[model samples]
Target: MTFPAPIDPPARLLMGPGPISAYPSVLRAMSAPLVGQYDPFMTATMNETQSLYRDVFATANDATVLIDGTSRAGIEAAITSLVRPGEKVLVPVFGRFGHLLAEIAERALADVHTIEVEWGQVFTPSAIEEAITRVKPTLLALVQGDTSTTMCQPLEEIGEICRRHGVLFYTDATASLGGNDFEADAWGLDAATAGLQKCLGGPSGSAPLTLSDRAVEVVRSRSRIEAGIREEGDASADDFVRSNYFDLGMVLDYWGPRRLNHHTEATSMLYGARECARVLLLEGRNAVIERHRRIGDAMLAGVRGLGLDVFGDVAHKMTNVVAVEIPDGVAGDAARQAMLTDFGIEIGTSFGPLHGRVWRIGTMGYNARPDAVFSTLAALEHVLRRFGARVPVGGGVDAAAEALT
Candidate 1:
């Protein structure tokens, strides 16, 4: 049963939660020839990648580095290494990814305490502070933006609250990093993790992470050195990190001047991640963030022009994504499928309780362009019309174009 190796060039609109339109420069960087892991050039490339990510993460920590694998890998590395079993951790669940943080902590055998809000709303800093006061959690785990409901949880106040409570604050910024503002040091974020796939305009294989000195101390105390790498009578030989692969302790050593080997580094993905951060830095993080804001505004106005109601409190919507309420009697999945199959556009749907009830449209990464904003709007309007939903022809695109202009 031989299958035809047909041309796999799929039509290219990416208005989704993640993997949103990789930058052409990033793709080119990935295609560059790979070098040996210990090659001088490769070592330099690793250093440069870490430096670039430091700027993107807005952190001065020397430990800022990339974790190979997806965003969840970064989450696992940050949590498993920093949180010892029985350490109390507070997690506030605003959406799906908050649940993910709780799950990771539980797997690490952390004493986890969680406070959940309704899907679309965010927990106030005071609410989280109260929880922290009650639980006396040593680590506070949360997601900056949960793409499931297109909500950007307020972080600034929460970070300060955690500081007062003596809680090390950690965040998963996978869906929000490049498109939104984050200050690792200024916000008192002890540790933070993000994936390159979302707003970073790169592939999903690398997760960028930055840890404050306090967070680093936690990792250092729990660290265990593997036997093979240890020297006889070495003072640090006994500190074997709990999870060998996801150990930030070893990862930092590998990324540091020691340049030790943990695994075969994902060279191509590192190149891609480096280039992604380079592009973001060149554009200026604040400008890139503003671009996402403008595109999201255009997309939101376009969705409204199509006679659809947007979900969530508009005041708190994430800068890179929007959640639109699927109108009554309109088949959300069918319209999404039609838009994908017929028009070659990909918009995302919601998750958890809002699944099938809302459409999560992304204006992020390379797809935050004006063309993508209008094309997605126009395609969505056409698909909704086919489903007998009364969307005004040309109105959506016109509105988007107006905003984009």
Candidate 2:
């Protein structure tokens, strides 16, 4: 049998919307020697990680923990655990991720209701309130920042609306957490979930999530009932969550003081997650967010100065990603290929409605820097010109440099 060669890979600047370059320290953290899941040191690390992410979420909730899968897992866990079958779930659809939330809720046997805006626009608070009044769903699941359309939906006022309507509020922050402002408690989020791969400067796999006391009450209700039944030698689990793997209550117990074993922890991912939070907190959370904001603005300016029209409302776009219209007469995929092959840089292709019409460029995590921004701008200029598009010789880099200054 033939074996593949040792994993040698090319070095490419990841300027696309996600899974950007992980921090070097985070990579090293994964190489640290593993230990037993219940070892004292391991448990302490887990507890410390929970505290670190509390500051990251800007929340005081004691139920904060890490989910074993990707950000999607966190989403499913929060939704399924909180809303039992046949409960009403309202999802505000702005882009692809919103649709994902609705689909997940539907699979959880929820009576799903949806409200949508145009791809590039977001819903007004009043619109959401109106929907809540009409649909009166038990839960409102929304996406905070969706990379698909480069839109960050304003969540502050909507939380209050959900509260007034007595609806549980949850948001998927996978695309926006580290790069944009997110206040879980202050914003009255009943549940919020995020992944490390975006602005956290780490690889995907570990999903950090937090739950409010109310959400916890709902989730633990099932656990209490199921545990009681199990102790009585009853095998029935009619009241238990459908998914054992993504069950947030079980995950919380494992992360909590009980140390109730669920699955064996992903030791390396936990290390990487801990280092990611440490790096963010060490640098100061607000400072890292500012860096993403600065670099993202520069990338937007660079694209504009390079003679590209940006997609979506500029005011609502996230701080780490921008979508630029694919210039007429230039093939989108071909230009992206040239950017990769010639310059060893990768910018993203659009998703859903924006596909083939625009390119999504990201300045996130470890790659959100002045040098990375300028380098991407420089390469983009060459690619656009080679594709027979009219672009200024140094317009992109010059504009980005000016923005940085």
Candidate 3:
């Protein structure tokens, strides 16, 4: 049987919601030679990655480590390890990803309760607090940024409220971590998870996770040694984490001083994750977030200049992505495909309520730049005009340029 030639894909400027182009440094790092899982160099590299992610997550938690999977893996690890079956968990839903958290909690056999606002809006602190007070849940699970609606839920106040109520707080920061303002320790977050694919400027294979001391305690309480590493006195919890592969207790031990074997670490992905954090910290966290804000602002203004209506409550939107309403006559999917086929660019489509109504454009990771933003705006204008929508030829690029200035 004949097989295909060596894999090659087209070059594209990814101006979509996520999986944006990775930083060159991160790509280079992934090509480094593989090392043994317990080699001195490998363990040291793991330790260094942990320290770097702590800085990136804005936390001092000693249990900070990378999960050897995508961002959703981090979320499931945090949820499955922290909440035993039938434990009450509260999820505040504002978008598709918020509903995702609730769904994951339910699959963990959690007694999940959810309070929701409209798709394009975020829940206020008071609303979340009211639900928390009524439910008296053991954990508050939420999403920091839900790209489906291009909304960022303000977490500082909600974190405070969760702390006062003695609830363990966890958030999925996959789409917003490096590009937005997030304070795991200061915001009273007990557990937080993020992916390298979005704002971290790397591929989607690694997930950086951090756990506060309180969250660590919760996971440790459910600790159970794997059969391969069992000792004479080892004891398992009455309700061990359902998924062995995602058990934070075992993962923590492997990442911790014990170095107990869990799984052979994905060495290349770990290198990429390390470089992603290094690039962010070297540039300074605040400066990277500021870059996202500036570019995101330009993207937003550019879309508006094309006579497009922006979706959601603009005041609480995320810094990395924006949702623009689809024009009356333009076919949403067809326009996006044209942008890809004709221009070698990619833009995002929405889900759930926003589907068929809005397009999600992103300026994030390595592509969060003046050139990328301007190029996307220019392409969008051409596509809109070709689709029979009225748009000024140079309006999008001109507005974006002005915003950058």
lDDT tens readout by residue for model 1, 64-171 = 898999999999999998887788999999898988999999998889999998888898888988899999998999999999989898888887888787889999
The estimated TM-scores of all candidates read 0.95, 0.97, 0.97
Q: Whole-model Cα lDDT per candidate?
A: 0.87, 0.92, 0.92
**Model 3, backbone clash pairs (residues 3+ apart or across chains), number:** 0
Superposed by TM-score, candidate 3 places the C-alpha of residue 17 at a distance from the truth, in angstroms, of 0.4
Cα lDDT, model 3, residue 106: 91
Winning model by lDDT: 3
The digit string of per-residue lDDT tens for model 2 on 1-405 reads 999999998998899999899999999999999999999999999989999999999999999999988989899999889887888999999999999999999999999999999999998999999999999899999999999999999998988898889999999999999899999998999999999999999999999999999999888886743366444345464467877777777888888888888899999999999999999999999999999999999999999999899999999999999999999999999999999999999999977778999999999999999999889988889888888999988999999999989
* TM-score, structure 3 vs. true: 0.97
Candidate 1, lDDT over the whole model: 0.87
lDDT of 3 by residue, 295-337 (tens): 9999999999888999999999999999999999899999999
Error of 3 at 137 (Å): 0.5
Clashing pairs for predicted structure model 1, backbone only: 223-239, 224-239, 224-240, 224-241, 225-239, 225-240
| Model 2 misplaced stretches (Cα beyond 4 Å) | 224-227, 231-238
* Per-residue lDDT value at 269 in model 2: 95
